[model samples]
Target chain A: MRRNSPLVPYLFVLPLICLLAFVFGLSLIRLVEFSFKQVRGIDGPWIGLRNYELVLGQPLFWESVIHNLKLFLTIPVMVMVALVLALLLYERLPGWRIHRTILFLPYILAIPIIAVVMKEMFQFSGPVNAVLTALSLDFMVLDWIGSADVALWTVMGLIVWRETALGVILFLSRLMALDESLIEAARLDGASWRQRAWHVLIPQMRGVIEFFVVISAITMLSAVFAYVYVIGGGRGGPGTATMVIELYIFNALIRTSLPGIAAAVSVLLFAVSLLLIWALFRVRRREEA
Target chain B: MTTTARRSPTGAGMMDRRRLLQAGAGLGALTLTGGLAGRALAQTPTLDMWWWGEQELPGLQAYLDKAIAAFTEAQVTPMLQDTAVVISQFQTAAAAGEPPDLQYLWNGIYHMESVWLGYLAHLDGLMDDGLLAASNHGPLSRFDGHVWRMGWYPLPMPWYYNKDLFDKAGLNADAPPATWDELLAACEALKTAGVEPFGGGVQDGYWAEWYITHGLSQNLDSVGDAVNLFIGDLDFREPRYHQHWVKLQELRDAGFLNKDMASLGLYPGIDLCVNGQLGICSSIGTRLPADAKTTNGRIGCMVLPVFGQGALAGRPVVDMQGMGIAAGSEAKEAAASFLNFLNQPAQLASFWEATGWIPAASGFDDSVITDASVKDLWTRWGKGDPITNITNLMPGQFYEQAAIPTGQNIITAGMSGEEAGELAARVAQEWRDFNPDLVEKYQQWASELSAG
Candidate 1:
């Protein structure tokens, strides 16, 4: 029997298994059970696919799904911005450290504080409007976060502002770890900066890029709740335009008292997260193979 | 000794291990029991009470403590909660078959659906036992023939105006708008003078008041049955709803209300009113002084303006807030007793003196309303102010589908008053569809009612 035997792997996994069983596994079981149950006032009875039917039949659920999908598309843009900013700073430009710190500061602000600041900055009489009026750009001024057309996008902007800093720091660390020898070698053949970054640096940073993409996707999906509740001013309004999956679940649970509906929404959210995770794994596996 | 000698080796090993496990189990049980016993003995049958209060609710808390001490002498514990957390907690508790003994429930038909759905326990026996006074029961709290919740305190949702602004505008501050025509003229006068007529942001659900006032006026004819069909089998396409919606839209178009109302919230509105930038602000209660110091020395409280004709004709819509006991409380007697004690004229008066709200209790003397701040409230509510905010007095199903939805619709431009009336009618039909048994149940409850 070797000291570093196959059994050691099992021992290493025991803590994780115990944690999953007690927490996630147990909750998932209850969630499934609840999704199929009937609740009257406080009492519950078994009621097959009735809850799922109600949930899927509602127009609001479809709207939430579409909204979250739109959020998914915006994540890539945010991540790319972060990566480019990090790479620029990593070129050892003047005051790069200071730049890094400034970019990273917003990541530390509390969510509620971020929400309050965002509200103030975007309000009709806020600083942005004042600046616009001063510059004679009054045509560009409108109720930035209050309009139904732009409320969702405003929340996305705030999320990007809050999250891009962390992404920048992550990319910066990855950039620092990159081997400089390949770049120098490639430069000996008269390779330009763009050529080197595209051929050598880009290929090398692909793994880190994939990692950030997966993480950012997950963050963007969950960010819907904080956006709607904190910044969207709590009705998921201007006309339910800002409503998303999390708010849908919350509305069902609080406003409708339909646990079955809430449970179905939870399952759908889980499936969404799982699909994203699987896609990430598939990409990684394909790359490795 | 003989058995040990005869036992197999496996048996002996198992016996020893089992004894050791038993000893460990005993130790664990003793620890839990020992810890719990002390706490159980010290337990003074406390009741958790939740309510909404401002930042400086310490005065109210102290007064509550005095009242509680007088009643149970340290038998109850009142747990204060903010408004945002109350609904979520109550929802969770309702789902779990447990809730606080006494809670400050919103007096709406939507809220009463919980009682109808059996999430709440009826206080029929409690009332019969003389623990709850039949006279103090508000129409909203009365269900079928029985009462479900007690309204211990009444939150008067009224208008807060600036006296100094009115004086500058050449309008009498004492006699505020008693009719729709007067209110419009006042607003027009202030508007011409470049003063903002309505002192609130249109964004932050402030537009509800515009529709609420309209609903109040419409229900003036059926004052006793205010908000009755909010979720009933009624049509939403009524003129009453349209009148309010069209008027609000016109205000939005004309720039009489704040143009950036959608972007600004309550604090900014309050700030504007305080600085005399606004002539009149539609707000409720005697609590405005605590938030901001206005040019007129805090808020001037008056009844909400009513429109239309008949019983609600002369009176202002009295939108209010109040408290109720939980239905499934294990400590029903204690909770009932506490609510009873709290509703007594003396205790109710004390609560108002401390909390700046009026007692919902029916009979109170001039001494109870002696405080300068509360005097305005006493004078207004003296001759039984019309309980407006009819939504608060509606049945649960109707309030959610009809009242709240219609209110939201009027603001969203989703439906006009006629459409809203039609929509309300549709909603009532939907309620009957979803809960096919409710109508008969309500009828039975109505027939069972021997007392008003």
Candidate 2:
């Protein structure tokens, strides 16, 4: 093939695709196979879809799915917060660099590190409630990480606080690369900041927003394990209140010694994740077109 | 806007020929050293031991390090496992046919699942028989007439009350509550005295587990009865089986548990009693040495007050941690020798001297114990008719999904005792469904235990 041909580009990337297939592909195959078996130690006799039947039939599985759905509520809040923050910074507010760094600091820190600090801070008699009690806001003080009804919400708050930073950075990067001329034209046409953000900049930045939403959807589904692990005291408790799908799968595999059940849940999560990745690709392809 | 692709000269030379040559030289040196080390190590077997304890018992690492050094039979390399990964890591390694020779085994179902999986070697023939018997590995370590693990240390499950708080409440400091009504009366007195009466930190769910360890056994005929509940031979919906939750609920409803109890962890909850902030909480034998010092020996230990009419009521509960040789291990004899060495009278004494806690072996000299509080614990829970920690017999599924959660729900979610029973029954069914293979094994074991 000619060096300039598209086939040459494909050849250049073929090795990585092969490597990825050998690495992740083999495990993915094993994971599906394990899902069909009643796995004990490393392997076990095949039980067909019995693992799936049990996992899906369990109420805890549905509870986990519901919790993940509840987390999906954060994306709208995150998008609004990130858009406003990014737009505000797009104007190059004073000390913007320092402000950006400070805003991004939570994302830079490991989830467990921040989650531990937050767990302590929000404890019933910890600083957050101590301040509330001191200020005569005793009714407002709930068992932040201990009460089942409030623990999942508390986990969501932490997720939003840390995860929104990624959105802010993503949106800000897109905003920075935008056509400033369009915003200036809108300003000249008597468009207010909000109007410019809504009608001009945001409309043009549709691709990044979709990208952020889909990524957040994926995260809330499969990646809130650390937040719940630390905040809910590591067992997704206060009575499984913060039990998301990832923690459910984790408890199945590691804690409960139900590897087949864990694998079944993993397959379900993997399928959902693939859909989100596919959505991510479509958005990217549309933007490129 | 214009963009610059900034690439440094050093960046372009990321894996240059000189660097490759240096890497090759380093690899050659490492290979040479590894060859020499392998030859030197061939005279004696190298036993890999993956253990866990330093998190729960401080100085355990020090004691183990000392023991490993003194163990002359093999070159034992110890890897301290994180609290969460201990079971999974061993099982995973064993499954892969490359398990460490020695593994720290938690009693009952914790290691029994590994036993059932055929990952652990039978300790009966491998280790010293008398020493193994003296180690008190507990009944859960045996199945199909085989022993799986050798006991390492004892965890006596006792409820601690603040003697100072009892006095402050005009209650007898010497006589802790022995009946359910007396416990209620004491809680009332403590409340009147402006002290939080009946809880410790439960945020980590261990306090909840330890509660069941002492509480549920109060209503069981034998440790095997606990197994029957999980294997579907019995149900948690029984009034007697779940009355422990009802008692816990009574405490919650009576405004007896600490207001902050739901937010604290197991150790910190124990601290509430030791520090005189709360009147009572669940505690362990290993904690008594330090806790006794913290409260100036004012901490009183007792079994959870009797409520049920079961045969096991009021018996002291002691859970033991143990060790086993992995079935896949090539150095099984060496591993067994190390476990045997640890249980010997001298090493057991060293364990106590280093960890400030009692070893599981009965051969250890108790005269060396100076702390009055720890001494009392050792005498009462360690000596006479002690029922094994029944929670140790719980299936891991029931433990994480039902047992821990049920206690948590009762305390915090306002879940009634009856509701907790329903939840337990449901989770038990779920466990049976998820693990049909294990259910048959558990049923057989349950029958053998119940008959015993």
Residues B1-452 of candidate 2: C-alpha lDDT, one tens digit per residue: 33456556678736878889999999999999999988877878899999999888888999989988998889999999988889999999999999999999998888988888889999999999998899888888889998888988988888899999999999999999999999999999999999999999888998888888888888888878999999878889999989999999999999999988878888888887888899988888888888889889999998888998889999998889988899999988888888889988889888887888888888989999888898889899998778888888888888999998999999999999999999999999988877878889998889878877
Looking at model 1, residue B323 earns an lDDT score of 59
Root-mean-square deviation (CA) per prediction:
9.6, 8.4
Q: Write the per-residue lDDT of candidate 1 for residues B1-452, one digit (tens) a residue.
A: 68756757666445577888999999999999998977875675678777655443336777877887787522776787765556657656765877877776666444566666666667767643353553344566667556776655555555666666777777887777766678778778778777877646544544454455544455445533333343342334556544555555545555666555566665566566667777666654545535333343544666545555445555544543555667767777677667767767678678767775555556544564444545655566534655545545444334434554454444443345556566566656654543444556544433332123
- Please, what is the TM-score per model? 0.83, 0.93
> Tens-digit lDDT track for model 1 on A17-77?
9999999999998888887876554447777887777667656568777777777776788
Which stretches of model 2 miss by more than 4 angstroms? A1-7, A280-289, B1-41
Each prediction's fraction of true contacts recovered: 0.24, 0.82
Clashes of 2: 1
